[model samples]
Target: MTQKITIDGKDYAVGKLSEEARNQVVNLRVCDQEIAHLKQRLAIAQTARAAYASGLRKALASAEVVEH
Candidate 1:
């Protein structure tokens, strides 16, 4: 079985690429994986931030009721 890679809407066999091209393909794959990981982390951090904001709001509201 042969592995194929697509670039610019065209498909080419990985085995036919030069060593430099193959290395570049590997780099592109690594970068894509890293980008996906960072996106997930950002989503998690945003969710946590939203939770923290909500908690702060509730705490402040409680404080105001106690002071009245």
Candidate 2:
């Protein structure tokens, strides 16, 4: 088996690496309610950064991107 990994535009040899690299996104609670919580957070964050905070809020409000 030939497996290669490229990171940061550089090739890194897998030395003492894990046999399986798995990433798990665990949502402790339902995201629907979390969105409201995030909105409140955005409001607090927006006070410090108007433009970027608004941008984040806008991006979060929009529909999820479809990855094909």
Candidate 2's residue-wise lDDT over 1-68, tens digit each?
A: 44445656966445433544311111323564699899999998877698787888899889687889
Residue 21 of candidate 1: its Cα lDDT?
A: 98
Against the reference, the lDDT scores of all candidates come to: 0.96, 0.61
By lDDT, who's the top model here?
1
Clashes of 2: 0
Best by TM-score: 1
Q: Mark the regions of model 1 whose C-alpha exceeds 4 Å error after superposition.
A: 65-68
Q: What is the TM-score of candidate 1?
A: 0.87
Model 2 quality (TM-score): 0.28
Q: How far is candidate 2 from the true structure (C-alpha RMSD, Å)?
A: 18.3
Question: lDDT by residue for model 1 over 1-68, one digit each (tens)?
Answer: 89999999999899999999999999999999999999999999999999999999988887856553
RMSD of each: 3.0, 18.3
Taking all chains together, each candidate's TM-score versus the true structure is 0.87, 0.28
User: Looking at model 1, which ten-residue stretch has the lowest summed lDDT?
Assistant: 59-68
